[model samples]
Target: MPRTGDEFITVLKKAHIEWGNHRHTSTRGVVYGEGYLQIPRSEARTIGIFNSNSSNTHIFNCNSTDGFLVNASIKASGSSTANDVFAKQFQGNGNLRLIGDWFRHVNAQVGDQVKISWTSPTDIEITKL
Candidate 1:
């Protein structure tokens, strides 16, 4: 049995995820478009989203709430799919965008900085900062 919070954390780290897990990946991004942000390929690599494949596009299905939009998603456009997936070309870089009216729901403005955090692999959350 764990006696303190810190001890519990250590125990959880040693145990399997089903027991308890608390880990996430975070990255900062700037809103470049009405509903999009550009993240460098290197940064995407650090966040574990970059794919060198240059053919398959990666999408991050996310959940966000601002009292209006219930669900939103982030897409990381691949090199080859960039032209077809989005109107803007990133010169082989990854493009992250908030689908639908999520930009307005989050009250995000062009050039505003936002934080992207995700746990496990699929769960994602975005916050303005």
Candidate 2:
């Protein structure tokens, strides 16, 4: 079953998403590997963190107050290794702005430089095609 936003964040925190004083930032063409995605200093935001998921080569979301966003995407290289499943479970904190797949590979350690990006949630009006 898919996890909620709050549940997701809890998992991230436990896994250790790089704790930064500033908010979000963008990926400046740097590739992040397993064990804590790096947030660059140039892309800091007021309330967001950008990360690359190693599994499907996608960018995922992790927030401070709100746990994990649900369905967001990131660009990754096709040559990267597949992310290992069955790592850990995420718990939400209820402040997710985006959404995506949650995993246990994130482990932002102390003093890890990360490139953050600010992505506001867009309200889209869906219609049957």
Per-model TM values vs. the true structure: 0.46, 0.19
**lDDT per residue, candidate 2, 1-129, as tens digits?**
112221111222322342221234464432222222322222112122212332321333434322443343332112122542222212122322111122222323344333332333311111111
**Model 1 lowest lDDT segment of ten:** 1-10
lDDT comparing candidate 2 with the true structure:
0.26
Best by the lDDT measure: 1
**Pairs in steric clash, model 1:** none
Model 2 alpha-carbon miss at residue 93, Å: 2.9
Candidate 2 lDDT for residue 5: 23
